[model samples]
Target: MQAGNLVLLLVALGAVFYFFGWRRSYAVSAPLGGVRHLHSLPGYYASLAAVWCVLPALALLGLWLIIDDAVIRTNLMASLPSSIQPANEVDYNLLLNQIRNVAGGALNPAFVPAEVVAAAEQLVAMQARNQQMMSIAFVSIAVLGGVWGWSRVQPRLRARQQVESVMKWMLMGSATVAILTTLGIVLSVLFESIRFFQKVSPVEFLFGLQWSPQIALRADQVGATGAFGAVPLFAGTLLISFIAMCVAVPVGLMSAIYLAEYAHRNVRAWAKPILEILAGVPTVVYGFFAALTVAPAIRGFGESMGLTVASESALAAGLVMGIMIIPFISSLADDVITAVPRAMRDGSLALGATQSETIKRVVIPAALPGIMGGILLAVSRAIGETMIVVMAAGLAANLTANPLEAVTTITVQIVTLLVGDQEFDSAKTLAAFALGLMLFIVTLGLNVIALKIVKKYREQYE
Candidate 1:
């Protein structure tokens, strides 16, 4: 049976065993004092039985799914002739894909080697055997576990304690998995960045102004000694982000204040969702809007005013990106503002303070931490945005503070560097990891600053 079907069967079997446990608990209670004398409620006993019936079988099913492909591939590869065996991991994967396609009838057997066809047949047989064994073991364990739980279901059984303990362990396991995944990603990026730093001096990469990363094919080619200076990229990123924040912060925050404090309930209900609809629009759509519509408008306006504006300028991208991320700030701000205690507002009013005064003095200060959090999230969203920047801001690593100039960000450069079949051995490819590490550092610094601000304001307000 398939894993999905087996899971469904186990769930149904657990339900049945739950009823058995509940009924048995009542029967045992009836002889004593009709459930009043029982150690725990009937529901707890029912849950215990369900846990026993499902958990062990589900564990086996999960284990089987994890290792089933490996076991089948091992058996099939063992049967292949030594002469035709894959020499490396990449070759093994390619051969396995070929065999899988042929076995699934996506490829014709007449077009391939006889050995591969034979291996495909063996693959099919092994999978069928594995499935059969999995189904049997899954069902048997569920049945035996249910029986064990039912026999153990006496008035003295601490079913509630056991169930709660299992739940606690499950939560801990989930938290551990999250922590490990984050650690693994950080280690992977850090190791690759170390490799990149070995190729280029960290001082040159950090302090040099030029940002050309195109690795040359010939020794005599132009820019053969590619400049990996990240200063230009950093300047462009900050310039664009600053422009975006200027547009987003006041507008989004004011709108949020209006919606949360002053707007009628009906007006807020419709307006907030319509405003947040911007967030739901895909980044590619925002990119297209920035490229075709906003960039041209900005360039035309600049020319009319005798200003030098690139066809794709930071101003255009930043404006559209600001519009894109407005919902992030607005939504979170509204939520936090609304969360301020109503009594505080009432108290302020009773003290003769106007609603605006109360908001400026009491509400905003109290909600400063959450407001800062929202702004930080919006800043991260703006910094990480690649599509809008790529579309509207032409990929020029110009170290300029002027928003009218075309410029590129670290994310855009990273995408450009790692777009195709890249040789990881090259400094060009490893530069993406270095850029990623820098981005991580910047984001962490932002979080630290925001946390300190939050802590200071939070203490003062509290």
Candidate 2:
């Protein structure tokens, strides 16, 4: 049977067990007076039986799928002629892929040697047998588990406690999986970054002024002497992010403040959602707007004002990116500002302070921690944005602070370096990992600072 069909069958069986256990519990309790005399409800017994029927069956199915491919490949290789055996892991994988393609009818048997055709036939037979065995075993186990659980359903079964215990452990397991996944990502990047630093000095990568990353393929190749200096990239990222923050902070905060404090209820209801709709628009759409509309407009305006501007200028990208990130700042700040105690605002006003003065002093100070966190998150979003920067800011890693000139960010270069057929051993490709590590560290630092700010100033009013 197919995996999807088998899963459906398992679900059907679990449902059967659920209803059976529920009715059985009532039947068993009838002789003992009523269901009120039972230790747990009929629903708990039903849930317990369902869990028993599904858990072992799902576990076996998962295990079978994990090992089935390797077992089939091993047996297939054993049946091949000694001379036809693959030489290395890469060749072995290639051979397996060809076999899979042939077995799945994607490749014609006449195009390959007779030995491969024979192996493909064996692969198909083995897969059919494996699926048959797996289906039989899983169904048998699920039925046995259901029978066992149903037989135990009685006045004193303690079904609720058992089901609740299982659910609690499942929830904990889910949390552990999330934490481990995050740790795994960090370790993988850190290890690859270590390898990258082995090829290039940390100091040179961090502090060097030039930003070329092209490694020469031949000694005679001109302008390919790779300079791994990252200063220009860092400077460009900071310059664009600073410009974005400048545009975003005042506008987003003011809008948030107005909605939270001064806006009429009807106006707040409509305007807040309309403003947040900017966040829902895809970054690529924003990128297109930056490239075609914003960049050309900035260049034309600069020309009109007798100022030089790159055709793809950072100002255009930064401005659009700021516009893109406004919702992040506005939404979070609005929530935080609105959460400030109404009594605090009233108390400030009761002391002869104007409404604006109360907001500037009493409300903002109390909500500043959360507002700072929102701003930092917006800044992080600005730093990590790629599409708008790529579309508007040209890929020149110029070490300049001028927003009218073209520049590139670390993320843009990382994408450039690893976009195509990249050899992992090359410094050019490995540099992406190093750049990723730096970006991760920078983001982590920002989070830490935000957390500290929140901790230090949180609940001052309370």
Which candidate ranks first by lDDT, i.e. highest? 1
Q: Candidate 2 lDDT, tens digit per residue, 1-462?
A: 888898999999999999999999999999999999999999999989999999999898999999998898888988988767899999898888888899999999999878888899999999999989988999999999999888889889899999999999999999999999999999999999999899999999999999788888997897566889999999999988998999999999999999999999999999999999999999999999999999999999999999999999889999999999899999999999999999999999999999999999999999999899999999889889998999999799999989999999988998999997998998889999999999999999999999999988885655
Q: Write the per-residue lDDT of candidate 1 for residues 128-212, one digit (tens) a residue.
A: 8999999999999999999888888899888889889989998999999999999998999999999999999999899999998
Q: How accurate is candidate 2 locally (lDDT)?
A: 0.92
Off by over 4 Å in 2: 31-34, 81-91
RMSD of 2: 2.0
Deviation in angstroms for 328 in model 2? 0.7
lDDT, each prediction: 0.93, 0.92
Model 1 local distance difference test score: 0.93
Model 1: colliding residue pairs: none
